[model samples]
Target: MTRKTTNSLEEVHESVAIVQNTSIWKKILAFFGPAYMVSVGYMDPGNWATDIAGGSQFGYKLIWVLLMSNIMALLLQSLSARLGIVRQRDLAQASRDTYSRPVNMVLYLLAEIAIAACDLAEVLGMAIGLQLLFDIPLLWGVSITMLDTFLLLFLLNKGIRKMEAFIIALIAIIGLSFLIEMFLAKPDVTEIARGLIPSIPDSTALYIAIGIIGATVMPHNLYLHSSLVQTRKFDRSKKGIKQAIRYNFLDSFLALNMAFFVNAAILILAAAAFYKNGMHEVAEIQDAHRLLEPLLGTHWASILFAVALIAAGQSSTITGTLAGQIVMEGYLNLRIQPWVRRIITRLIAIVPALVAIIYFGEAATGKLLLLSQVILSLQLGFAIIPLIHFVSDKTKMQGFAIGKWTKIASWLIALIIVTLNAKLVFDEIETWVTTSENPIYIWLFVVPIAIFAAFLLLYIIIKPFVEKNRTIPNLVPHINEIVVSESNEPIVYSKIAIALDFSKTDQKSIASALQLGGKTAHYTIIHVVETVGAMVHGNETHDYETTSDHYYLEEYQKALEARGYQVSSILDFGSPKKSIAKVVNENDFDILVLGAHGHNWFKDLLLGTTVDAVRHKITIPLLVVKDH
Candidate 1:
């Protein structure tokens, strides 16, 4: 019976294998297509509207936001790329696995809502751009955009590279249109140069500047860029990985630099055309275009502005769709049909936008843009904090982690963003409660609520360390006893083991092992216990599994495979110390590598059973990687 079942399974697997093998190009293309689609989010029409508004209102006073945002973009994109490359998974997916279920659900819901909000802006921008270009009704234009689903499917089927090339072409057209507009307007080059210098005009301008920064960097783009990096199917060799990282950085830098220039051009053009003339009445994206008609010749200016808006809207929509996919896949681990996700996101976004449009009529454009930027600003912290923590953790990254200066810069940027958003939320609430004519008894309700929220945030910031301390003490010998080992043997083995539960220090240990080579050395990865405690034991299982031998072994094998290394794995149910020693002795391993602090070691050492057991029982060299 078992043989017959095995044969049936093999037959099914073979059939699927044949299908997958036949579509190698299709699979490769699928990976390449998403990044270009995702890149559009950076240069979306909503961003154009904000950039133009910022320029028209403040006249290059807000240029610093663009500069700062691009820098932030670079740092965040690098983190995203590293996450994808090192973990072989998207950020959302990682979060779902790492975080508590409640935390995961909350994050997923927030991200999903955020993505939907973003899609609304893209869809609205596209519909409006269409209306502007073709003199179609806004509602009709919106209805027409429903066809994007079919378009997306058709493009995906053709090949991702084809889609990327097409998007790049559109971007070029948009870039050219902006360049022509900038040259035609011919703003004072000196004034444009001055815009590059940083100075805050006022508190209100500061807030608006922050808004622009938030708008430009965006939360969804982080998810998109990381997932996009995975499309390269990067070679894991040291040199190859390094090269992949280099090219990725270059790609991101180029893409974002173009985004910077495009954003700056909009602002500079507006400043040159409208600001110098003391015209601050421009509200809508279309208004910015109309403002250009009087300054530059009407025919060329209107046409260029319309075309650029169209390009921005279409390109951004494509990216927004892709971002939605990454967020869904990463956070939920649900590979829902792409069209379903797209349509759901589009519908959510469009309903709010349509309501705003219907209610406010022409005034809705600026409000829609502002609302989108504000939502992005609010959601920034959720993504940014995780990014900072993950990248800065040396344990997770091994040698390919973020540098100290980069971490400092990342933290500073994240702090500034959090502060700005906090300030915005506070000010908005203050205005609503204190200054409004109908001063609600709700002030009694609002103050404590605000205080509680602040406390909650403070707690979350320190929660990881607090929890760590509560659960386990450091297992490393005192610093005084941690003398660097002096060895005559040339270190030949560099082994790295990756696991979901291991701390950053564990990652560093793996890196250290790799650095310390051994003669004919091989890195052995083992995951001993595979079955989840909930499935195997019951609700009594602690958050941190003491019996993760199978889990570790499986992950170790996977990491080895990812690095193109052959590894021997061991799975055992009993004491990890005994098992490890037996494996080491049997395999003739020269060195034993283990996390300085782990499940069995703590209890075993306390009971005087662990280190002694390994030291006496195993003949191989032992390396304990210390975690910071």
Candidate 2:
């Protein structure tokens, strides 16, 4: 594809051209990037090893696993893209702001670990592929893979489109290699068709089947997709956003379709040659390569297989490293040195992977792959649950948020993933206890402790809702006052009400609102509905009075007072909307300026009561300045 360079003015024209250019074929092509990016997970080195093993051991029967997994991947990737295009932010960042501190922290920690593990896999895959193709030592190849950090940063510096183009090109090479290999292998047609029909041969096949599904739709990909689509810089207009979303969906579909074909090809090659030949004991990735030699000419089979592995490893690593940056910056709102973060994460993950590779050597390939995927599966709940919560909450998302149907679908998928992980954890624990021939003290103590931990986790989940409901009633009256005061105004437009949230992005919005409104109106900063109960209960702190409140007030007061306008600061206990309304009703103001930060679609829709309630109930025209 030839790259198109254009400016903001040209972007509209170009975007229109893109929309007009759409046909079934064009849409199918556009779907390639997202699906290809997503498909990397399905065809990652770990997945390749497993797919090859599964097919060689169980023949074409396990091909159904890959097919089912692709369907689930389609559903999840669509949700991630929708969330990004609609909310205009990544999933991790959205969840961080919407969820409570402890919950958010827990989720962040788990997600970070998962991303690191994913990076580890990518690095290992690359290293292994290097060993297979170029005879480079694994440790040296791992170290060499660090250069990808600079490569990715360089690509991103050029712009997002370029990065996406590079990834798409890499996916093309991988896809082409597999297609050629499939044609050369020439597997049986009837048996390949039979593989598409789902049937569980035994418990082991079922477990591997589940693993295949779990491995395909990776959790970090959610973070990557959401953050990646944000780079397109589409116009904030409704039509423009809708068009961008449509194109994104098209991109994902094409990429995944290619991924599906590549995945199927790998399975078919293994099934045709190894399964039919009664190779039931194929144990490692290297073993599958040997089997391919007898079916296809040895040189072509080895070269194509190695090239595909190298492509998968390199492409997935680039994306995984980028995802780590997005997660850290988005969720924590912390901007660490990018290289420092990369090195830290890489070092942490490489230690365990290297130890296993060195200690168990080639024999541990299957174990390493399975363990990495298991870790990913365990961490998925942290990412998935928050996505469900943020998308469903009308308070956070404005008009563009997830609807009921999307919410239900997302919830069902999340639940199934969680259930699968839970079963894995439980079964692993049961096996450990049964196999341990040690004293009863070990089993008795460990079992109860695990049960208690699980119970505590459940309590923690329910506790937030209980506290929110209990405190909401008291806050209601204060909220009601703001709702009622929506019509009133002060004589001076100087006093501006800024609704503060835990999100640091709110600070940016507040800054912009004061700047825009300060030119025409003198402003007073007011933080309404400060919940004393939360502070007293130790759930929240009175530190807002000192930290956020004091800093912003001092900064704005200095800025306004210098400009010859009187400034006053108020931090009151009540609903923000009602308190602002009451203040407007009580004071004679020329106009009311409120800051609107576009965080979530539902939240944007209701204007957090401060803007919307005032707009609806107040007599004055509420000046809402949205910080992009």
Model 2, stretches more than 4 Å misplaced? 1-35, 439-559, 562-628
lDDT (Cα, tens digit) per residue for candidate 2, span 1-628 = 1111111111111111233344756643443354555567667776776677678778888887788777777767777877776775688766654556676676677788887667666777788778788989887777788788788768755645566688778888888888888788788888888988989897667566656765677888888787666544445577766777777877777777777787778777777777778887674666776667776766778777888888898888877776776676666665344466566555656666677677888567666775676677667766766566555555444555677887777778777776776777677677877887874865688678556545544644455355433211121112112211111233344445554432333445445445544445555566553433222323243332334444544555565566554567665554566666776777665566666655365544423334666677667656665656
TM-score of 2: 0.70
- The weakest ten consecutive residues by lDDT in model 1 span 1-10
lDDT of 1 by residue, 190-232 (tens): 7777878888787767666766776787888887776666545
lDDT of each: 0.64, 0.64
| TM-score computed on alpha carbons, candidate 1 | 0.68
Q: Lowest lDDT 10-mer window, candidate 2?
A: 4-13
- lDDT of the structure predicted as candidate 2: 0.64
